[model samples]
Target: MTITTHSVTLDGVEQRYHVAGNGPVCLAHSGGPGIAWDYLRMRPLEEHLTMVYVEPIGTGESGRLAADTDYTLDNYVRYLHVVVEDLAAGPVALLGHSHGGFVVQKYALAHPVDALVLYDTSARTGAEFFGDAVANIQRHGQKILAAFTSQHAEMTNDELTDVLRTIMPAYFADWRVEFEPLRAAMRIWSGPSRGQDVPFDVREQLSALDVPALVVVGEDDFICGPRWAQELHRALPSSRLRVIEHCGHIAHVERPDVFYPEVLKFLS
Candidate 1:
């Protein structure tokens, strides 16, 4: 991976990004409203495609704004635009994980992406998206975060696997098995924080899409389960939803053999 770092000015704010690998271009996005970028180490796929992983404004090595800066979905949309423009890759096989799914979905809807591989992602807007997020902050806002530092392994390995197991079983046909370390990295990539609540009725617009999109949902992901992926597939006429038999929220992480191969197939 020939890794390089660059800065792009967006709204007078300089945001830093990392680019690596070479092949079909993909903009890999990490989840969490304020998680660090270390969790995006998908080096295996890097061998096949150039993965441009971005650190959203105010997180990781990315620049920050005023404490009052709005991290809404619309702003994140613009942030994504600036990153893509900086890469000069007008269209890419947009790849997003978990909450990042919402970000890229907004991008593809506004622009023409070559294709999209959304792993354990959602496309609809409702209380379900924001309700649990806000409730999490209200529940464990500062107590745990205040202790967090700039460490790669934020949580114990067991703690990490235990939490992911919550939704991993639904993504595939089985569980009680070991997942890859990259999956653990992705979990750390997705901090438990929530983004600012911004609701939009994106469902009605999916059917109007003219580009190809793939929705992968774990059967166990109660939050964005098979039913959720189904709605997204229905909305986008060119979209296809594949329900991983035994996985959940972090299908790409829990079932990478299943996840990575399926993504490559979709993009191919």
Candidate 2:
């Protein structure tokens, strides 16, 4: 694949993207609300599809400002439109991971694309999970796990594994075994802006999408599991779902050997 990097103007701001491969272009959007695409390292996927990784306005080496930039979901979607046009490539596949999945779903809803890959992601978030699970984790974090140790004294490392294995994999293709590392390895890059709170609903707009969609997920993804992907696949008229064994949220990164071939099968 021919790899390249360049910049483009969108929303009157300069943005950077990494590119490679030679088939219908496939673009990647990373998670973390402001994570860098380098963490995804899509150069390998580049060999199968012309991969283009976009560094959202605030992440990576892209433009940054100290004022209100209209960082809403619609704004991000609009930014993606400008990106597709900038690529100058026809009928590209738009793919995203985790929170990146939310961005791509919004983008796909707003615009048309040849295909889509939503890797362990979601568009509609359950307040219960985000409010209870996420909030507690953010507040207590590792301490919360330590607290559990007090009650379930016998809940040793293996026991914890069993619990996570049962719950987390319902969302992933591979289950907790594949997802734990990716989740732990993920380094969030949110600016002090708290700008990720955008209310974008795919249910209202997704039914209108006509593009072929692929929902790739890990069995171990505790956040957004296989059920999330399955919901997406069932909703989109032109879509299919796949699960990567022994993989998690960042399935492409953790099990690239499996992810590449699966992605190639769909893209090819």
Candidate 3:
């Protein structure tokens, strides 16, 4: 939990990052494509790797792009390339969650990495991912639908948190339990980058990857389900797919016992 924060200029953008733990440098990226990096603090990872959590160009303490700058996937990859060159001593492990997964995949395609840990992620675009999500919800999402229907206007902070807790069950195999320890540790910092959705298809690009990869997913993840994980594994030449039982989108938070061991083994 002793994290050292660093800010450096990369290609004219003021990039901020947090480093913790000890061992090989691992560049970590959170999902949301916009959520604050704090949402991805995994203490278990600190035991095996020096975790470097990079705030996206416009998130957390990181600087923003110009008004006319293109927020395309290529630009994001360029930014990450500069970050890796600026921070990593050599080829470093790449860890990405959700949309961060997409970024990492593209990054690996452009710049090789020592290893890749893609959690609850896919190689498809937002449209394809959401299309699968809709079908997945229809098949096994009654509770989620009910919770969604019950949402009202302008909830208080606690009420909003309560609703989130209630709906979280749908994201897990166990729909009635809450992981308060993980929940309490998360930091919520919203920014303008939240709605920057870009379309991409990297299934072909993944086939050329040479580094070992770990494709881990939650069995109960509605958005990036087992099939997407499997698809990513199939596309990669050297990769292992692990589906954690009774888990959800946030596999590291939902099942660190399984996640940490698998990741450690892969990195080892």
Residue range 90-194, candidate 3, lDDT tens digits: 889999998889889989998869999999999896666767776666555676565444533344435544544555555666643367654554443233333
lDDT for each residue of candidate 2 in 6-108, tens digit (9 for 90 to 100): 8887656777877777667888887756555666767766655677888777665777634434555566666677789988876578888877788888877
Order of the predicted models by lDDT, top scorer first: 3, 1, 2
Candidate 2 colliding pairs, count: 11
Cα-based RMSD of candidate 3:
3.9
Q: Which lDDT values do the candidates have, in the order given?
A: 0.67, 0.66, 0.76
- Best-matching candidate per TM-score: 3
**Residue 30 C-alpha lDDT in model 3:** 79
Please give the distance, in angstroms, between residue 115's alpha carbon in candidate 1 and its true position after superposition: 1.0
Q: Model 1 over residues 1-268: C-alpha lDDT tens digits?
A: 6788888988787777788887889887776555556565577778788888888776766766554236667777788888888888768888877667888888888987898877666776577764633333232334333332223235553454444434333333444446544344443323323334556558887767778888888776645667667877887888778888767666655667777787778777
List clashing residue pairs in candidate 3: none
Estimate candidate 2's alpha-carbon lDDT, on a 0 to 1 scale. Answer: 0.66
- The estimated TM-scores of all candidates read 0.76, 0.76, 0.84
